[model samples]
Target: MEKYLMKSKAMHYVFVIIGTILMAVSINLVYEPLGMVTGGITGLAIVIKELTGFIIKGGIPLWVTNIILNIPLIICAVYILGKKLLLHTLFATLCLSAALALVPSVNILPEDYLLAAVFGGALGGVGLGMIFVASASTGGTDLLAMLIHRFKPYYSIPRILIVIDGFVVAVGAMVFGISKTLYAIIAVYITTKVSDGILEGLKFAKMAYVISDSYDEIAKAIMEKLERGVTGVYAKGMYSDKDKKMLFCVVSKKEIVDLTELVSEIDPKAFIIVSDVREVMGEGFIEYKQ
Candidate 1:
């Protein structure tokens, strides 16, 4: 057990290191040079950096301000997201801060606003996605989202993040002008798109929850034809006040259409909910070998 715990901690550290590098590359190579303000503390940093040149005489610098902004959020995460999450987030945030401070300045993109916005957003989005997959974050609005999620699990965290970012972009517009605002919007869009793509790319399985009168037939078919396993969960219908069997299964996307069709043919009244699962570890799923 101690060995496993140490291994897990080591993996988290590895993720933090990798996530930090990607984030630094995105910020230094793309966002900062273009002045594209993204969401989160990084975005706020860009806004501040623009207003005041990156010149610090004494005390904490603008870069430090970005790190400090996450302090309150980190405390909240510690209470809400648990100790492991708190440590991972703190490590990831510190790595990001250090990377931004240490990476030698470089200008990769031309002064063209369009290129800057597009590439910067894409890079930042990929970095964010990687950070999420690592189960760590660079803090900022993500901490707020986690806190909000603790209170309202049903609320859409990404949507809330968008709203927060939108406000930041609005402020950037006021200070930087409308043109930069437009570029920032473009950058935000790209970041979202790329982040989603990266997350989806990391998905390993699909979870299917099936509600059907022909539960037996579906289960048999899944076992015999798909060579997949199924677990029957006893469910009580709210409106019908009748007990029913619901089938839960995880399968590859290759079998999704076939599964749907088999269910539809077996019971036209069947209800099926399919969702992408990022990672699954257990019987019939990806399992780590000892």
Candidate 2:
């Protein structure tokens, strides 16, 4: 238990570090320089700062506002995702906020708005992806999405997030004018794309389901040549009502082409379906059981 706890803590720190670096790069190099508002607490803060110019006395500074907004989200995470997720998320959020406040003192990128938007969005996405991999979040609207998901599991979290973010962007347009608001939308889109890319890269796995006449040979080849365990599932063809031996195995993307070629050589008419799995956990995968 002690060993596991230490390992978990170490993993959390690694995620926090990656999140911090990405957030810092996005804020300093892209979003702030370009005056592009994103779809989170940070975006809201940017608009507020641009409109008020730091003159809102007694109200929270953008930095403080960020911390405050995440509080409820963290609480929600504790309930939805569990205590371990909450702690890692808190660590990531604090570190991100601190990086934003501190890193600006040293300008690190060009002032071109387009460049800023593209790179900043990419950086922010990667950061968010790292946080997600750790089963944590940087809070904000994500917490709200999770809370909603907890009570209504059928509701799409992504759609909920988009609606909330859209509202926020509308507010930004009203406050920061149409031009800045449009740029913010662009940044948000870029951020989402980059985040997706990062997540995809980090958790790339292939799920292959094969049905062929040469089931035994194919299974043997996969197990021995590929050094991967295969599950021989008893399956029935829906249309034909014929019994079949279905071979299921998860492997890396690098092996997909080779696996396909090998299957083709053995059985030219084999039916193979390949799906991209975001994450896998267990022996010969992510080691979740341990």
lDDT of each: 0.75, 0.72
TM-score of 1: 0.68
Over the stretch 24-107, how does candidate 2's per-residue lDDT look in tens digits?
767656665556666778777766666676577523445667897788778866866789777767877888788777775233
Q: Pick the candidate with the highest TM-score.
A: 2
TM-score of 2: 0.76
Which residues of candidate 1, in runs, are more than 4 Å off? 1-7, 54-62, 71-89, 111-119, 130-135, 189-201, 204-222, 230-250, 258-282, 287-290
Q: Mind giving the per-residue lDDT tens digits that candidate 1 earns over 1-290?
A: 11222356576677567767777777777766666666678778777776656454332343586788989889877877899888778888888888888874477876777888877777777777667656677788867766776788676455556678898888877767788779878888887777665654544688899998889999999899889999999999999999999999999878888889888988989999999876666766655555
Q: Candidate 2 — which pairs collide?
A: none
Residue 157 of model 2 has an lDDT of 47
Q: At residue 217, what lDDT does model 2 achieve?
A: 99
